[model samples]
Target: MSEPAAPADTIPHGDPFAIFEDWFAEARVTEPNDPNAMALATATPDGRPSVRMVLLKGHGPDGFVFYTNFESRKGHELAANGHVALLFHWKSLRRQIRIEGPISEVTPAEADAYFASRHPESRLGSAASDQSRPLENRQVYLDRVAAVRALYPDGNVPRPAHWSGYCVRPEAIEFWHDREFRLHERRRFVQSADGGWTSTMLYP
Candidate 1:
């Protein structure tokens, strides 16, 4: 008979970045929609917290990236305090990852390049919206979109200065997996002072 596979809780101690990539790739295959979607958590300098969903545009040793209008609530919050947290839950796979970090803005050139890669309609919508601000009516926003379309008939929309991306440089990462009979498994990795990772198992 073949030997049984190792338990999920028995995750090997290794490079956390490599482990994250492996799990993310599996999520991409199994998730029915927006596998890159993650919850971003930010706080005011005074300590109130807010969270919302955002798409993961990129990731590597540097960190995870996502774009938004710099004038938005998240923008304001991040400007005041760079500390942030991210959560990814793959329902189909019964797995979750938590990340905590400080963020930094991407270069203007990088923002422009990503903006150019978006669909023309998406570009127009982004350029026109005063994100996170109260609007008088839906028609007002539609009219703004129409105005942008008229100005960029050739679909050559220049990126707005207020629109850009931020990268979160993680200080810690934790992975959780659902197991039989509610015996979940949790593994956390904390960046060490000497630039290595320390892994620990948490009761679940």
Candidate 2:
């Protein structure tokens, strides 16, 4: 399917955050699964980069939030390099968002709260799985999960100290909309030194 015709108003709002929220809400209705999914990009100590799909669990004026184990590979990368980038592509909507910013961990209390909200099995799995680590066999992970289940038989799993959330306080945000004749529309809002956004339209 092709992209819809561009509306008269192509200029995103003065606040990129608000524009993001509007598109996100639209995607929620259009996307088949995990509408808030995004590609998280992180870099190793030597500048080698990696990208993986992750859910965008929260976003607002505070910034974009996602949760994971602090001991994971991405977590370690964020620790070593505070700079991070993210991309959100909604296939159904034929739109995308690119964001770059400094990453920081969310509060421990916030992590605990989000952890508590997850299903019992998910919480247990997250606690048992050694993310980004090599395992000898599948049984090793299953055994660990079984052990975790036994330790918390009642399914009241506690958030592991290593698991938490991070928020990206964006310094640059770009919104892209597909257009006919291969001339897509791209607009970027960069954070200015004065604590405001400078909007610019880029050539497709």
Candidate 3:
């Protein structure tokens, strides 16, 4: 199915965060799968880069938030290189958001709260899985989960110290929308010294 036609007003002016919220709300209704899914790009100190899909667990004026095991590959890269990028592509809406920023860890209390809110089985899996690490066999992981279950029979898995979240404090935000005849639309905003954003458009 084709996306709805994007008129001139498709890309709004003013705060990019507000614009993101509006589009995300639409995506929640239109997207068939995880609408909050986004591509996270991180790089090592040597400049080698890696990209992965992660859920947008939280977002607001502070910036976009996603959780992971701090010992994971992406986490290590983020620690080595604070600069990062994020992309949100809602195919059903034919809209995308590109964000560039430096990351900061979410408070431990916040991580614990989010962890506790997850389903019991999900908590168990997250607690047991050694993310971004090689495993010998599938049963190895299953056994770990079983062990955790045995220890926490009530399924009250405590959030691992390494499992936490990071927030991207965006320095730039670009919004893209698909248009007919292959004439797309793009609007970018760069943060100013006073914390306000200066806007501009790019040929697309």
- Cα TM-score per model: 0.95, 0.94, 0.95
* Over 4 Å off, model 3: 1-9
By summed lDDT, the worst window of 10 consecutive residues in model 2 runs over: 4-13
- Sorted on lDDT, best first, the list reads 1, 3, 2
Candidate number that wins on TM-score, 2 or 3: 3
* lDDT per residue (tens digit) for residues 74-115 in model 3: 988998999999999999999999999999999999999999
Question: Could you give candidate 1's per-residue lDDT for residues 23-55 as a string of tens digits?
Answer: 999999999999999999999999999999999
Where model 2 places Cα greater than 4 Å from the true spot, the runs are 1-9
Report the Cα lDDT for residue 140, model 1: 97
Candidate 3, overall lDDT? 0.93
RMSD per model, one decimal: 2.1, 3.0, 3.2
Residue-level error in angstroms, candidate 3, position 2:
22
Question: Each model's C-alpha lDDT?
Answer: 0.94, 0.90, 0.93
